[model samples]
Target: MSCCSTSLAAARSFGSVCSPPLTSSLTQMSSMLDTAAEQMMVHKDFQAALDTCDRGLESLANMEQEDSRCGEVKAGFCILGIQALAELNQWHGVLSWVLQQYEHQEKIPAKIMQMCILLYSKVGEPAVMQEAARVWLHCPSNSRVTGFRTVAELYLLHVLVPLGHRDEALELIVGEVGGSAFTEDQRQAALDVVEEKEQQKQEPPLNPSPNSETTAHTSSTQGAVVRKLEAMLRFFYRKLLLTGSGSFSLRKVFTAAVLLYMLFLRLDPAHPSSFMWISKLLQLLKQMWSAMFAPYHQALTHSKGL
Candidate 1:
């Protein structure tokens, strides 16, 4: 028999002893394609690597109705394809491919979606990155991926902010920080972005000459700062109040209170709303302090009574 025939006969024999013929065939095909693509990339044959990735993706499409294991394999193939395109500096091509896949499917795989976001960021396409971030946030499988929340935050700070999407960036950060789905680290990262942006807003223009344009710009910035400060205060207050049962962390409460105090000081003292927020923050801090000492107070009272 010829080499091809002999290899086919051996594959069939192996498949008979394994799980299923189609599953084995697909698995082997994916592995072989991945290896070939990697080798081509190492050799700097980017076009050849891209061609191999295309073949792998075609195979994935043909096996669309497969099991969960197969779905994962397909996602891997998609990632490989994206990487190959990136190696070739075909960023727009990668975006088009991802968008086309999104248009056809109800949901793209989480790993694939991540690759798309990373590609957009790599290509400096902030508008596309923002849209990808929105889709990623809403994806049902997003929670399964590790570090997705951090990735979302980085995208907000690095992409959205530079693109002048300040409102959208703040909205995304506030939503994540306020929601229970985020971890302390993620919440803190979002808060850092808020603080950084607030500082930038507070910086006076180097050119102090009075002009209509500069005055208008300064007013707009001040307004945005006030709104961000209010949003952050609300978030920290909710966090302080929600510390129940095993979730009570005194350190977190203290941190939130300190941040609120700093923000209060940053606000314009003449503004009527600033005074209201300052009073509210002080009351919340007092309540938290009392709550922290309540158990000790009860113990002291009981001992004295005894």
Candidate 2:
């Protein structure tokens, strides 16, 4: 991917420019940063790029306080370094490496925080950035940056919501931190979304059994019977796999036949004594039947579209 010209200089002096010089002028430091960028973009040598960024950041450390150019240059190198780490698939090290540069989570730049949030979210590990993003968002200094609201939103959606931190997410929407990040209407919407998620969590999972209210209320007898039969077979297959015992032995099949006989051939709903036992058995079996399924069933369903 192409990078900003300011962040990635031309590739003329693109040799590994590690430790340019402690006394590098703005021009010299700028050239050194180009080496790291070239290593990343042109050479595709991400490790070399990270090495160069490290040296450039070290050179810019003292100069950062004296010159605005130095800070920009350092941020450029940091960005390059971050991309290099991601390219290398060293996701686990990203947060720690960033914290090493800033010394504190709250001190990391907002732009970098935004990048980390997106990166971790992409890697399916948004929980990794939750604490760091939370700390940075709470920092008053970072609260006014242009990317502040973006960071807040990403943290809420990508990190907090995915990780199920409802209490903290709700607080962030209505609390002072959110006051600067989100408007009243957005806050209300966020609140609604959070509450909805909570309600979903509290509700029991929909049972796909033949005896469920959904199945019983169906108008089509044929469709209901088909669904119930499928559910029954799936439950039996899953239970056999889950128990990991006997490995689909014929003995298990015979046992199933006995239960089927008791239900269909023997049990009579008109008789109160038989009705009680049937209801109790169905209830117990329904409890035992989980949504879990064997991998073979999944493969079969996918291949045959069943």
Candidate 3:
């Protein structure tokens, strides 16, 4: 088949999944979201998937009533949209997009809030989610949701501890949110975890990581290389000095081979300033080549003149 026809066939196949026939069933309600999911997972088209999610949300918003079914569909789009946004590498815009959907931070679904918390935490900006999660946890209506405790745990471990908000963390455990979400034993365990993290923060590391010694090791290694290079150059130069054109041997060729190997292969090994070795070694090799071949070039010129 022609390439254009083949591409049209593939596009039609995608449409079958993305734009399934509209029906009144609950499954049909999420057909658009399924399309977005297919775009993200199957096609790897994150931006198109995000656009599909926006259209699905717009369809949901135009509905007359925000029933439980509408809520579920909306959550599906929002969650898939969040994944799409993250896949697009636009994590910074996630919180604002979510706020635009729900109008208030406290009204965000617990599962969606958990997603936002995990997203920001993964990026090492857990504090970005702190105030939003705090408001959601304090919402009286959200207290009884199935994901409330999970969100609370994420808030404690990902948000609170990472930000060093020990006072607020303690208060959450003893106060309303923690008391409502966690069992007595779970609360105690949470306290121990927080305390352990705090103590670890306060104490100095007993031993540094192996990476901390890299500079010292590389310095010593490079020093040994420089010493070896200098010794090789001196020995070769002296040998060339003692030998005239008649006494010349393949020793110069062998020395040049060794220097080439040193210069070209196994030289850097990921050292940051390895080019310094290359620069110095190249200059040394240039000097050696001149000293080794000076007589040969002179003899060739003299022969040509004769």
Q: Which candidate is the best by TM-score?
A: 3
Regions more than 4 Å wrong, model 2: 1-24, 62-65, 207-306
Against the reference, the lDDT scores of all candidates come to 0.60, 0.72, 0.78
| lDDT score for residue 118 of model 3 | 88
lDDT of 1 by residue, 1-306 (tens): 012223223223322333444565576765655554454545656567567656765776676456655555555545555665766667677767765555632256544555566567666775776666676665656645655665565566667765766677667666742352366676677667766776787799877777878878977876786566556665755665576423457546657666766776676658775675566656766766665677778999999999
TM-score of each: 0.52, 0.60, 0.65
lDDT of 3 at 132: 95
| Candidate 1, run of 10 with poorest lDDT | 1-10
- Model 3 residue 201 distance off true place after TM-score fit, in angstroms: 1.2
The collision pairs in model 3 are none
Compose the digit string of candidate 2's lDDT tens values, residues 114-134: 878888998899988988998
Residue 226 of model 1 has an lDDT of 52
- Misplaced by over 4 Å in model 3 are 1-29, 208-306
Clashes of each: 0, 0, 0
Scored by Cα lDDT, where does model 3 land? 0.78
